[model samples]
Target: MAQATPAKPFLLPAAIAATLVLCGLIAWMIESRAVILREGTEIVLQSEPIDPRDLLRGRYVVLGYPSQRIGGPLLDPLRAEIGEGETIDDATVYVTLRQGPDGYHEPVAVSLAEPDEGLFIRARATRVAHDMTWLFLDFGIGRFYTNEHRAPELERRMREGALTEIVVAVAPDGTAQIKALRQAGETIITEPLY
Candidate 1:
């Protein structure tokens, strides 16, 4: 009978390959977030608590923004460009923001095309009023996760009217990541780039 090649040598190489792939995947995820946090523009946005409880999602705070529902002058140009009978649902929109005196960024204009200059956020139109007067957008920066021990206290403070603000790092493409969370001008929780 021919001697069978040992399985141990093959198994070792396969295990090494699997570990390398897992490490590479983990490294890629960390580097992506780190790039945004390290190189992107930072903006502060006023945040309010929406719903913080979710059994399936674990401990986190759901945030809502005043600029989420946009209307008035901001929608005028966009409406005229698209014309009547055009559907706005699921459309990509770039919302230009200007820093207010209070230091929070506020939406000034919304456009279908990305702004060539200035700080803007890219959002998807979630809903539009039947009259085409207003557009509701989802910015994808709505949740801030925290540890179980701290989640309840943060929720309580927000519910009791504590002013909350989020510091977000916005990439050139308008993708945003939550860099820090603040309550009453004090930094409560910060996200590490690593």
Candidate 2:
């Protein structure tokens, strides 16, 4: 009887193709964020430390910005488009910020359309309240990373009401990235795009 040889499967080729696709996707994501950090328009926004009870025990600082909660007449224009029973529900929103005499950025308007001029950051509205007066949105720029040992001191300073703000770079397409963390008008940590 002749010995039979098993045919080779094509799994190897398929895996290689899949890996290439995955690498391409990862590269695209990295480059997109890098562009925002490297060449995007830079703006400064004020933030305060919140709930040190949790931050002191963690490795990162939880900073809250006034611009985060945009309400009142500011929601009027965007609210007009929302229909009955409609919720913001993770919707991408554009928030326009203008530089103040204090040199800090403040939200002037919110819209579904991307603004052609001025600085704007793209945010995802996580939840829309029933009255639509206020919505919890994620700017993707939260959660500044820090060393475990440094977390305590940073959290303490912020808790003690130290003046700290974040520098953000906003891309033309509305994407924004955190560029640096500033305290007392000085940069403490400069984040890398990559």
Candidate 3:
């Protein structure tokens, strides 16, 4: 009987090592999804979707804050709210919100008459996910989210009695992100006025 040539010894061990690496990778990936990031609050801002060509992260969903919701521009709120001799200059006006119908914060912009007269919520300016310097609230992927516009309404909402909540999250680059003036303490029933 002819002796069979000995099979190469490297094949079996290589196969086993490859299998272990693949299995380890699969297990880690499955476990990682269970982790939650950003121990913080959620704020639902009126956002209109946008897609703009940028230097990076091409064609993404951008949310536009509802700047003009209830009041029309023709009815200058400044004229109605402020007295004579108040300069309509670019002032860092803080909005105070009052609970509107159905218990939503309706923002009323206040002219800070005296220095340090109002309560200001804390917020941070961050670089958007390894792209531009534009800052936004980092909600979990595929969940409720908002942009810089959220800040104004949130401040206004608080002015309308909607209290802002602090949110912190880790970005893709491991940077801690934060948002301020987000209505987090109260449970908001997101609904249309009509």
TM-scores for candidates 1 onward, in order = 0.86, 0.83, 0.29
lDDT of 2 by residue, 11-35 (tens): 8899999999999999999998888
Global fold similarity of model 2 (TM-score): 0.83
Q: Distance (Å) between predicted and true CA of 133, model 2?
A: 2.5
Q: Candidate 1 or 2, higher TM-score? A: 1
**Candidate 1 lDDT tens digits, 1-194:** 99987667688889999999999999999898899888889999988787566688689889888888998888899998789888789999999999999989999999999999999999999999998888999888988787898888878877887857889899999988889888878998888878
| Among all candidates shown, the one with the greatest lDDT | 1
- True-structure RMSD, every candidate: 2.6, 3.2, 15.5
**Residue-wise lDDT of candidate 3 within 1-194, one digit each (tens)?**
99999999999999999999999998876444323133322222333333333344333233334322223332255445544444433333333334445333334443333225322212222222222212232222212233445434543454554543333333232222233223544444231111
Any idea what lDDT model 3 has? Answer: 0.36
Q: What is the lDDT of residue 174 in candidate 3?
A: 26
Show model 3 residue runs off by greater than 4 Å: 1-43, 57-59, 68-90, 102-104, 113-194
Task: Provide the lDDT at 127 for model 2.
Answer: 73
- The C-alpha stretches of model 2 lying farther than 4 A from their native spots are 6-15, 51-58, 83-85
Ranking by TM-score: 1, 2, 3
- Candidate 2 lDDT at 74 equals 90
- Model 1 TM: 0.86
Lowest lDDT block of 10, candidate 1: 48-57
